[model samples]
Target: MKCRDGQMIPKEQRCDGIVNCADGFDETVAACAELRCQSEQFQCEYGGCVDGQAQCNGTIECIDGSDEKVELCGRRILVRPTTEPPTTAVPRCELPKQPLNGSYSVVSETNTTQTDYVLSYTCDPGFKLVGHSTVLCIEGTWPDKMPRCVQTCQLMKHPSIVYECTEEETEKPRQCNVEEIDGTIVKTSCRKPNYYSPVELPYMHCQQGMWSSGPVCTAECGTLPPESTPLVLRGSTAKFGEVPWHVGIYLKNPKSKKHMQICGGSLISNTIVLSAAHCFWNENTQRLEDVTNYAVAVGKLYRKWYHPDDEPFAQKSDISEIVVPKLYRGVELYYKNDIAIVIASRPFEYKLYVVPVCLDFNEEFSNIQLHNGNRGKAAGFGLTTGMRGSESPVLRVINLPYENYESCLNLTSPALSRYITYDDKICAGSLDGEALCRGDSGGGLAFPSSISGQRRFYLRGIASTSPPTNDQTVCNTHALTSFTSVIKFEKFIKAYWYP
Candidate 1:
């Protein structure tokens, strides 16, 4: 072959199956590229040309001749077999394929009974577990959605109070276990003297399953009583309101007959009497006297029915000690600290009719409010709307309503308009004086007849004062009459005066 430059013609200078140009410019240099055939100009010394294409196709004709310069090769490219190794088959021992962005694995392999494989699963961050941790993987796809491990429950320290099972040790702390259903376990127990309402007794439950959120442990603050238990009064039930007030003379009475005397009082306890404190005091000296003159004439439905008709009206004995807090100084006909405990001369023969009312020491009126709100009943033998000295011949029970404190403060001007502040006092009456009679003072306000019901009056506020000298009806005015909330003095009363 001659050079492209056509300068030399010697046969020895020709490309003779060897590369002589720096760039392998000879076309016959690839002549031994294993073309399997020996043409006179080009032939292979080993394997055949890849794809049956001639190794040198008007370009460099050897395996290494692929390095030829483009000027000599003229855009010609010689083909060759690729040298990459083949891929190996996948092994069966490896874990099943996971999704692109999550983690999953075959928890249990398929068996003859089930063609399904149980898959264990976990999720990326910020996700919560919603479904089962193990799911069936059938025919290369999961049978159900995979579960995720995530943060859900309100992270909590130990609970403030916890409930224990009937046989469980009291000393041990309560724990919240995982629920069978999908939800977080929260809440624990009830504190003493405060039992859960029966409906609320099964204290522990899942938030999402039962409640919309966390389990709120409802703790009680007062005496824990049985379900539907009423403070049963044991004596005769009087007429609608038939207890009479008898004004009689007692031995050792004031010789001058000028002494203020309260002939009848309610038996709050065997030892205590619910009477007007101002009735026994001297207006000038402000001194209380003659504790023994007091007597509780219970069951006196009518004044003249003392013997056969009324069964002698069960005469209870006289008092032992007259204990009235000295702080109770007469402020006005409107008595303050009007409450006095007459240590009963003897333990009361606890008859159903002579039951002691439960007292409200904390002033907390309700644990849960009823939808219609709480309407209470008040019974007394005092005056009516207009009659001054005309007291009811029989005790009368009237329905009364309680008013909010802040709203009552807005009426009759701020200085004169007052809200009930005595810890032992509670207030009742609508903005309009639509309820309560003149003789309702010094009576007990009962509460929460049942756990399921609104807090009924057992012993709440003591009737303290009437509203300021304003004509506005108790219902229409912004302020109304208030009673003393007894809860403030619960400890004081229970400690010193409770028999």
Candidate 2:
């Protein structure tokens, strides 16, 4: 049927709380004034009726052409008998989500019609709102896409301070994954370490994209924790993470394909190590060892064989550079100016298990100078009599008595005597069958640190030579072992490390 304006209308649209004709003519005592319709009959304009097959069957049976109104004539149409909620399939689907920087609410799709939903978003603290204010709920979806409550942070008020999101510059293939609920965090800190802040708080909490609090600027130097001494062990298994300053030097011969423990060293800095020059430079041959396959293993208490389960991660570094004295010359079975500094291939991150030891860079070894009986500890992974030339599984240290300065020079090897001077070498002797042996060369001879109010482990000397074995399968006892005096070469250490 046609309305007064000659507009076509579907026969089923009559009296559907809608007017098919102008001036309320369709629903006013005409059209669909009746509450019901026959099964095969559909009411048309002005109470006219047509067969169901004539409705939207691609043909117009009504005089008003109401049967074929394009929509019903083409697409499958479901006629509603009442206003009761329409039947829909399983509605296991959830609402569309918004960004993490804002909060959202579901005003519709609450176990009701899958159609029509109103989604609204609110920006979090320290953030600004953007995008659409409200989302339209149409067919269980927002016809107008949900607005994003963009995360934003105010510029750092302090001009010298700068920050970047933690997730932004992190290196890939991280060792440990830390899940953060607040998402990517950008931390603001001082631009540089030398700029000098009272507190070195380069780290701060980041919520959303905004700084939760003002960026902190603290100096890194002044905030280091006060030094403390670890418990001294008496020839027992070194506890994991203990004696962290001790190091193992391994050398692999590329030509022979033989890898072996050549010497021991001490960690003095993140990338610097103080060890005997003999580990690399041979004084007798006046030639340097092939260092291409040399590496230092730190953070390991057990030597030679490390238990994978006990210490899963062992930090190893290749020797990138080495410094030896210009005047140094090789002595038969030993060398002079025996000290050297080693630079690591990669930067080291010092932790509890891998820490640098204190050094005698300022002639600070007063305890050794005070008495001839000062018992210094000499530790290494060298061979013991029980092992019969094999490297010790655990680090072995002996309480070696400091020999008198004058007596040390006279009693040491006749060959080293010409090279040894008053202040260049440190001498200590062991009474028992315990002494730093072949693999112990370049190891640190640790003494009680003498920094007032602090008792940190300090390297007294670096091992150079040991007496040959006598009456025992290992190094002989009651013989003086000479070491490269750390104090004698303090100028070299300070020049390179502190400078």
Candidate 3:
């Protein structure tokens, strides 16, 4: 080896506790400390090596006291043999396997006699971790189970749509793909009352660890009947598509077991119809009639309940439920809150002649001035003329001008006028003799309004009652007919409207 002074010396003279170089560089502690020991030797902390058998022998062998240090001898027992190298027993751990659809990296590692490892886990873009993100390996084994990557679903964002997860307890929106478990059911609905999902009863379902997308909400409603011409004349026959929302309510007679058109109703939704509560009242039993005994026929032009020609275009549904306001007291309140919603056994399919009419939501047309000169239309298969007149064989519509609250009160009979109130009733009829009669008790009185740049008919009133005349006529055409205001009972209607 060469000394610091550029003098050459025999390698055996280096670190031999000798001052061979004149400058003493060969015996310097810093220079000798850089030299490493062979596998069979024990190294001193500051300078030189010694025989392996002298290590941890309960005595200080190396001059720097390194061979007998507590840290080195505490966890290891170095077996000494002159013929063989020293041996040590150590604990070691191997690398753990990566999870599926995920990856891991070593955060820290040790290669000494006692080995240890730490790993951090990460999932792919569309996956989520199912366990701890970090893990420790000790004594040749992982301390915790390996994390797994699971498939997750993302929820849709829309202004009119609301989403709810069955598994979540909090109301806050979930972070993307977090806590979205497989087989979870997410319910979807419209945020607004008038808005609805294009898909009925829309929902999202998770399958195979993935979430399916749900339906979007829309406010497209009250579409006019296709190919139907609007008529301005009063007391005229309704076209096939003109009164598509009109429905004939039928009741089965106990003795005859035959269905007959007893009242009229209007389709407000695919599964709901707006009618008068009295339509379902059984006078003999003094209670509401059985739902199974009632049926509704939609998109019918014929007045007859069993018309052969109307079968192809009209759809019939069995009655499931009939809901009336709890505040209603039948005739004691003088037909106050007479409105009722009839739920169909199943949803009706929208067709050219079978569509729902818009309900008077938010009192959009509550102002009487809007209908001052513009007449509202009412359609029914009731009597065409006097009280005793035979029921019309075809559907008919009558256009009538609306009367103010005070004027309607004056025109009503004194016996019934006391019970009439502005909040519960509306007056509409023509003195020239066009009016709804006996069978029109539950029919809808709809007025056309422009909504979203389109003309749509909205139901404003439900045909309720008319005062009896002096001649004992059941339906007097000259009398102003009283209808239950739809807007006044909006809460009750909406409560039962959806599902």
Highest TM-score model number: 3
Local accuracy of candidate 3 as per-residue lDDT tens digits, 289-406: 7898899989899977678989888888899999988777677767788888999898776666776787756653467323555577788888766656678888888877788778
Better of 2 and 3 by lDDT: 3
Clashing pairs in model 3, backbone N/Cα/C closer than 3 A: none
Give stretches of model 2 more than 4 Å off: 1-237, 255-258, 282-285, 305-310, 332-334, 364-370, 386-390, 410-416, 431-434, 450-454, 469-474
User: lDDT per residue, candidate 2, 245-344, as tens digits?
Assistant: 7778888767876556778888876678888887887555687776676888877666753457436646877888888887776564346788878878
Query: Candidate 2: global Cα-lDDT?
Result: 0.60
- Candidate 1 structure, TM-score to reference: 0.42
Error of 2 at 377 (Å): 2.4
Judged by TM-score relative to the true structure, which candidate is superior, 1 or 3?
Answer: 3
Residues forming the 10-long window of minimal summed lDDT in candidate 1: 240-249
Cα error, candidate 3, residue 82 (Å): 72
In angstroms, the error of model 1 at 12 is 99
Q: Rank order by TM-score, top first?
A: 3, 2, 1
Cα lDDT, model 1, residue 216: 36
Q: How far is candidate 2 from the true structure (C-alpha RMSD, Å)?
A: 14.5
Candidate 1 runs further than 4 Å off? 1-268, 274-276, 302-309, 332-336, 360-373, 411-419, 422-424, 431-438, 452-457, 467-479, 496-499
Best-performing candidate as measured by lDDT: 3
